[model samples]
Target: MQFMILLDMTIVNVALPHIQESLGFTEAGLTWVVNGYVLMSGGLLLLGGRSADIFGRRKLLMIGVGLFAVSSVLAGAATSTGMMVAGRIGQGIAEAIAAPASLGLIALLFTDPGERTKALGAWGGITALAGTLGYVISGLLTDMASWRWIFYINIPIALLVLVLIPRMVTESKMVREKGAGLDVAGAITSTTGLFAIVYGLLQAVDHPWGSAAVVLPLGLGVALILAMLIIERRAKDPLIPLRFFANRTRSVINTASLFYMAAFISYTFMLTLFMQQVLEYSPLRTGLSWLPLGLGIGVGIGLGTAFIPKVGVKAVAAVGFAGAGVGLFLTSMIGVETTYLGGILPGMIVFGVFAGASMPAGTNAALHGVTEQDSGLASGVQTTALQVGSALGLAVLVTLALRDAMGEIQQGVDVDVAMTAGYGLALRVGAVLMVVGAVLIAALLERVDTKLRDPVAEMVQHTA
Candidate 1:
C-alpha cells in the first residue's frame, strides 16, 4: 500500500507532458496535477495520523486504499483539467488517511530496537525503490498505452490491499482520555492554509508578485496557519501535539526533512522537464535514464543502515546530505548541448546515493524513542514534513525557474537556452538548500553513544 502511494509521487513525472497535452493544461496549470496531491496530503497528515491513533490503523488503511482506487478511476477517466485536478486532490486526501497508518503499523509491529531500525531501513529502501520504478512504469504505460494507465494501475494494487489487509493485519488504536475529540478544526485550517499558499505561489506564474491574485491567497494562507497554531494550542486533543517537538532528534530531523525534500522535489521536477522538453528524450528513454540513480539509492540505503550502529545518525545523515548537495551542484552545470552520459549520470548517481542514505538515517532519528502509542503521530509528522516540503519546494522553485525563463526569453535568449538557464538556476538553489539541511543536521543533531545496540536494547527492556 505504501509502495503504491509513493509510486504515484514520481510516476506522474514521466507522464506530465502527456497529461498536459491531453487535458489542454497550461504550463502553470500542469503543476497542479502534482501539487494538488502533495499539498492536501501534507496538510492533512497530522489529522490523519491522529485519526489512526484515535480510530484504528487497519480500518483507516482499508478506507484510504478503497478511496484511492475510486479516486484513481476518476483521474484516469477525466477529460478536463478541473476533473483531473479534482481527482488528484482526492488521491491526496486518500493518501493522507492511509500513509501514516501504514508506517505506524510498521513501527508498532517491530518492537525490538535493532529489528525496528532494520524494518525502517527496509521501508525506506522499498519506498525509494518504488519512487524510482514509478518513472519506468509510467514511461512504459504512457508510451505503450496511454498516460491514463498510470492512474488505472493503482486500482489492482488497491484491490489487492483491501483483500489482504483484513487477513494479515490486526486493528490498533491509541488509548485516549475520556471525552477527547478529533482535531477537525486543526485539520481544516492546516489543509486550507497550505492550499492557499500553494495556490498563491502558482498564481505567480501568471500574475505579478504584487498582484492581488498572488498576495491575497498568500496572505490568507499565512493568517490561516497562524490561526491553526492558536487552535492547536487550545484544542482538547491537538492534531500535532506541540510537545512532540521537545525530542531534539525528532524535531531536528523533521526540520531538516523540509529542506531536504524541498530541494530534492524541485531537482526531480526540473530534471524531468529538462530531459523531455529540452533534450527531446522519449518517455521510455527518460525513464530508463533514471535507472542509475535508482540503483544508487538502493546501494546507499544499505550502506546507511549498516553504518548507523557504528557512527550514529547525525554523522551519517550529515555526510549524506552534503554529498547529495554536491551532486546537485554538479548536475546544474549542464548546458543545452550536453548529453546524458557525459552530463547527467554522474550527478544523478551522486545525488541518488547520498539522498538515499539520508532517508533511513533521518527516519531512525525522527522515530527514535517513539512508542506504539504515538507511532502514528511520529510517522505523520515525518511524512507531513516531506510532503509539505515537496509541495512548497515545487511551488517556489518552479515559480522562480519560470520567472527566470521568462526574463531570459524577453531578453532575446533562445527558447531552449532560456529554459535550461531557468532550470539550472533552480537546481543550484536546490543544491544550496540541501547544503543548508546538511548544516542543520550536523550542528543541531546531538552526538549519540556509538553503542546504539546496547542502549536501544536497554530502552526496549525497560519499556517491556
Candidate 2:
C-alpha cells in the first residue's frame, strides 16, 4: 500500500516527455500532470487523517484502494489532457485516503515502541526503495511497453492491497470529540490557496513578474492561506490545529524537513530531465543510471539505523544534511557534455547516502513525545509538508528554469541546449536549498534528543 501510494508520486516523471507528446500538452501545462496529483493529495491529507479517526480505518483503506484502482484504469485509458488530469486528481484523492490509513494501521499494529522503531526502519527502507523504483519501473514500462502502462501497473497492486487489508491488517480504533465538526472551510481555503499559488508561479514563466495576472492569484493565495491558519485557530475540530505546530523543536524540524524535501525532490525532477534531454539516454538507461543512488540510500539508511542509537538523532541529521548539501553542489556542475560517472553518478550516490542517513533522525524528531491518538495526525501533517514542499519546490525551480531558458532562447541558443541550461539554473539553486536545510539542522536539531519515536517515516523519510 505504501509502495502503491508513494510510487505514483514520481512514476509519472520518467514518462512525462512521452505523455506530453502523446497528449499534446503545452510545455507550461505539462507540470499539471504532477501538480494535479500532489496538490489535491497535499491539500486533503489532514482531512484524510481525520476521516480515518472518524470513520473506520479498514473501511477507508478499502474505499481508497478501490478508488485508486479504478482511477488507475481511468489514467491508463486517457486519450486527452483533460481526461489525464482528471485521472490524476482521482488518484490524489484516493492516495489521500489510503496512504495515511495504511501508515496509521502500521503504528497501531506495532504496540511496542522498540518493535515499532524497527518497523518504521523497515518502513523507511521500503519507502526509499519505492521512490527510486518509481523511476526505474516507469522507465522500464515506458521503454518496453507504453507509458500508459505506468498507470496500468497500479491496478494489480491496489487489488492486492484490497485483498490483504482484511486478512493481514486489523481495523484501528476511531475517535470523535462530542459535537465537534469537520473544518470544511479550512480544507477549502488551504486547497484553493495552494492551487492559486502554484498557478501564479507557473504563469510567471510566461508573463512579467509584476503582471496582475500573476500578482492577483499569488496575493489571493497568500491571503487564503492566512485565512486557513485563522480558521484553524478558531475551528472546534480544526482540520489542522495551529497548536500542532507550536512545539518549537518540532516546528524547526518540520521547517527543515520542508526545505530538505524541496531540494531532494527537485534533484529527482531535474536529474531525470538532465539524463533524458541533455544526455539523450533512453528511459531504461536513465532508470538504470539511478541504481547507484538507490544503493547508496539503502546503505545509508542501514548505517543511520545503527548510528542513531549511539550518536543520537540530531547529530546524525546534521551530518546527513551537510553531506546532502555538498552532493547537490557537485551535481550543479553538470554541463551538456558531462559524463554520467563523473557528473551524475557520484553526486547521486552522495545525496542518496545523506538522504538515508537523515531519514531516521528526522523521523525520530518529528514523532518525539507525541501520544498515540495524535500519532496518525502528526504523520499526516508531515506527509502534507513533504508533498507541499515537493510541489512548491518543483514549481519554483521550473519557473526559474523556464525563465532562464527563455532568456537563452532569446539569445539564440539552441532550444535543447537552452533547456539544459535552464535545468542547470534550477539545480544550482536547488543546491542552495539543501544548504539552507543543513543550516537549519545545525541550528535547530543539533542539541535535541529524542528517546522514543511514534511512527516517523516520510514519503519524502520523505515524507516515504
Candidate 3:
C-alpha cells in the first residue's frame, strides 16, 4: 500500500500533458493539479503523524486507504478542473494520513536486527522503484487508455489493501500522556502557511512577483509560518517537535534529502515533457524506455543492502550521491536529436542505481540515534521533506523553464527551439542541484555504525 501510493504520485507526471489537454487547463492550473496534492500532503504530514500517535496506527491506515480509494474514483470521474483539483486535494489528505502510519507500522512489525534491515531495505527499494516506474506506468496508461485511467487504476489496489489491512495489521497506540491533545491552532496555521507559500511560488512563473496572486499569498504565508512557530512553542502537545532538530545527523540528513528530492522531482517533471515535446516519443515508448532505469534501481538497492553495513552508511550514501550527480549531469546534455539509448538510458541507469542505494542509506541515517518515542515524528519529518522538496523543486524548475522560454521568444527563436531551450535550462539547473546535494552528503553525514543491525530492534522487542 505504501509503495503504491508513492508510485502513483510519480506515475501521474507522465500523464500531466495529456491531462492538461483533455481538461483544458491553463498552464498555471495544470501545474496546480500536481502541486495541490503535494502541497496538502506535505503540509499536513506532521499533523498526520500526531494523529497516528493519538489514534491507533492500524486504524489510521485503514481510514487513509479507504479515503484514498474514494478519492481515486473521484479523480477518475472528474470532468471539470474544479472536480479534478478537489479529488487531488482528497488524495493529498489520504496520503498525509497513510504514509507516516505505514512507516510506524513497519517499525513495529520488524523487531529483530537482521529482519529490520531487510524490511527497511525492501521498503527503500520499493519506494525508489515506484518513483521511477511512476513515469512508465503513467505513460503506458495514458497511451493505452485515457489519462483518467492513470487515476482509476488505483481503485482496486486500494480496495485490496483496505481489506488486507484489518486482518493482517495489529493496532498500536503511541505511549503518551493520557490527556494529550491535538494542536488545532498549529495545524491550521502550518497548513495554510504552506499552501500559501507553494501557491505563490507556482504563480510566480506566470505572474510578476509584485502581482496580487503572487505577493499577497506569499506575504500571508510568511505571517502564518511565524504564527505557527509561536503556537508550537506554547502548545502542550505540539504537532511538530522542534527538539528533533537537535540531532545534528538527523537535521542534516533531512536537509540533504530535501535538496536531493528537489533535483529528482524536477528531473522527472522536465524529462517527461522533453521526451514528448522535443524527442517526439509516444507515451508508451517513453514508458517502456524507463524499464532499464527502474530495474537498475532495484538491483542497486539489493547490492547496497548487502554491502553498505560492511563499509558504512556515510560512505554508501556519498557514493550514491556521486552517482546521482553524474546521472543528472548526463541528463542535462539531452537535446532534440538525442536518442533514448544513447542520451537518456545511461543517465537513467546511473540515477536508478544511485536512488536505490541512497534512499535506504539516507533514511537509515536520518532516523538513527533517535529514541523510540520520537520515531513516528522522525518518519513524518522525513516524508514531509520529500513531498515538500518535490513541490518546491517543480516550482523552481517550472519558473526557470518559463523564463528561458520567454527569453528565447523575445529573441525571435522558433517555438520548437524555445520549448527545448526551456527544458534544457531546467535540466541544467537540476544537475546543479544534484551536485549540491552530493557535496552536502559528503560533508555532513558522518561514519555511523551501520552494523548496529536494526537500531529499533531493542525498542520493538521491549514493547512487544
- Models, CA RMSD each: 2.7, 5.0, 3.0
Put down candidate 2 lDDT per residue, 7-103, tens digits, no spaces.
Answer: 7777888888889899999777888888888888888888887777677678888998899989988988999999999999899888788777766
Model 1 TM-score?
Answer: 0.96
**Candidate 3 residue lDDT tens string, 1-464:** 87778777877777878888888997667777877788788888888877887888889888888898899888889899889988998999898888888987776677555676688899977876776677678877888788898888888889889889888989987777878988878878988998888788778877887899999988999999999999988888998878878777777778878878888877777787788777788888777776777787888788778767687777777788778878877877776778888989888888878867887777777666655565566778888888888877878787778777877888898866787778777877777766777788778777653232343677699899
Instruction: For each candidate in the order shown, give its overall lDDT on alpha carbons.
Output: 0.89, 0.81, 0.79
Model 1: CA > 4 A from native? 447-464
Indicate which candidate wins on lDDT.
Answer: 1
Look at candidate 2 and tell me the lDDT of residue 333. Answer: 80
Error of 1 at 366 (Å): 1.2
Expressed as tens digits, the lDDT of each residue in 1-464 for candidate 1 is: 98899788889999999899999999888889989899989998888888998899999999999989999999999999999999999999999999999988987787776787789889988887888899899889988999999999999899999999999999999877899888899999999999999999989988999999999999999999999999989888888878888878788889889989998888887899899999999999888887888888888899998998888889899999999999999999888998998899999999999999988788888787666678888889999999999999999989999999999999999999998998888889989988999998899897542212335567899999
* Residue 274 displacement (Å), model 3: 1.0
Ranking by TM-score: 1, 2, 3
In angstroms, give how far residue 269 of model 3 lies from its true place: 1.1
Clash count per candidate: 0, 9, 1
The predicted structure with the larger TM-score, 1 or 2, is 1
- Write the candidate numbers in order of decreasing lDDT: 1, 2, 3
* Model 3 spans with C-alpha error above 4 angstroms: 210-212, 447-464
Please estimate how well model 2 matches the true structure, expressed as its whole-model Cα lDDT: 0.81
Q: For candidate 2, report its TM-score.
A: 0.94
